[model samples]
Target: MSGNSSRRSPVERFFRMSLYVFAGLVLLQLSLALLAEIWPWLLGIGIIAGGISITVWWLRHRNTW
Candidate 1:
């Protein structure tokens, strides 16, 4: 056999990228959640903005992937 590999489909690639983004966001949110205890207003705004951006991204890409 050969060692060559096939390229991933666009949808598969997009899904994998999304997974990575989701994981990073989860970590970021976790840290923000912890910091929120110290600065509730600032961290709360950051969290809300992050949530909105994530939701918009999902809505736009959901049909493509």
Candidate 2:
């Protein structure tokens, strides 16, 4: 049981890290959107890039998390 729990700890850590990364990406995209009035293209690019990054992260970590 102890060994199993130890193995699970890494998965939990990875999950927590991914969550933080996702949150940061969201904030960045929101900031870009807010600045879109000056550079209208940035909001669209940020949304697309953020979506792709989150999708890739989810795919890579889905099994572990």
Candidate 3:
């Protein structure tokens, strides 16, 4: 009766895990909502940055082939 006194029951553990998952989802939703207005700008910057990086990488590696 005392071997696992600190361990939670299976049902309690399941509910705790579910609560954590629910909280994570809520936080994700809130963050996405907050970023909704800037999402397009962020995407555009990402695309431009990615293109520039790729071009630079290609220029540096082109002579290897």
Candidate 4:
């Protein structure tokens, strides 16, 4: 039989929610990064790209939490 089949506690749930939130933020940052390539009204692709790079790090780590 398996030895790790129990429900999560409240703290675990909190962590799970936070992880998803961070991941979502990362996706938003990524969208902003790509938006510059499609839209010409903006002039900050470099900044958005930098932001996406950093957020991607958080996204990968959050997936583990």
Candidate 5:
């Protein structure tokens, strides 16, 4: 009975799971708010990086095909 007593009940487990979900949602909302503020900069950098990557790949592989 000592081991069983140490284990959490279903209600306690459900509460813990709900708490985790709530915390994760709070964190996700905060991160999205921050991302919204910096999204344009991120989008610009992503586009430039992607363009450069494609250019480099084309230059290296253009003659292979």
Candidate 6:
């Protein structure tokens, strides 16, 4: 309402981008999990990748990396 240009600040842009990436990763996990359900070996790999993604996200936010 203040007639501002509504530009995103650097932190806001980073947050938005990270959120989108996190959502995309989750979607990918779902797809891979489904495939893994059909072929069991992929289950372990998919889970490991998911864990790594979460760990990386935690590290990023913790250290602003």
- Candidate 5 lDDT over 1-65, as tens digits, reads 57888999999999999999999999999999999999999999999999999999998899787
Say what the RMSD of model 1 is.
17.7
Best by TM-score: 5
- Cα deviation at 7, candidate 2, in Å, is 11
lDDT of 5: 0.97
lDDT of 3 by residue, 1-65 (tens): 79799899999999999999999999999998989979999999999999999999999899788
Which candidate gets the maximum lDDT versus the true structure?
Answer: 5
Off by over 4 Å in 1: 1-6, 38-65
lDDT of 4 at 45: 75
Better of 3 and 4 by TM-score: 3
- Cα lDDT for residue 35, model 5? 99
In the predicted model 5, the residue pairs found to clash are none
lDDT of 1 at 29: 99
Better of 2 and 3 by lDDT: 3
What tens-digit string does per-residue lDDT give for candidate 2 at 1-65? 57675565777889999999999999999988777766757677889999999999999999787
* Model 6 bad stretches (over 4 Å): 1-4, 39-65
- lDDT by residue (1-65, candidate 1, tens digit) is 45445767899999999999999999999998887777978778899999999999999999788
Q: Which model is ahead, 3 or 6, in terms of TM-score?
A: 3
Question: Backbone clashes per model, in order?
Answer: 0, 0, 0, 0, 0, 0
In the range 1-65, model 4's lDDT, one tens digit per residue, is 46565777899999999999999999999998898676764546767888999899989999999
Deviation in Å, model 4, residue 14 alpha carbon: 0.5
Model 5 is weakest, by summed lDDT over 10 consecutive residues, at: 1-10
For residue 55, give model 6's deviation from the true position in Å.
51
- Predictions in order: lDDT: 0.90, 0.86, 0.96, 0.86, 0.97, 0.89
- Which ranges in model 3 have alpha carbons more than 4 Å from their true place? 47-65
RMSD of each: 17.7, 19.2, 3.8, 19.0, 2.5, 17.4
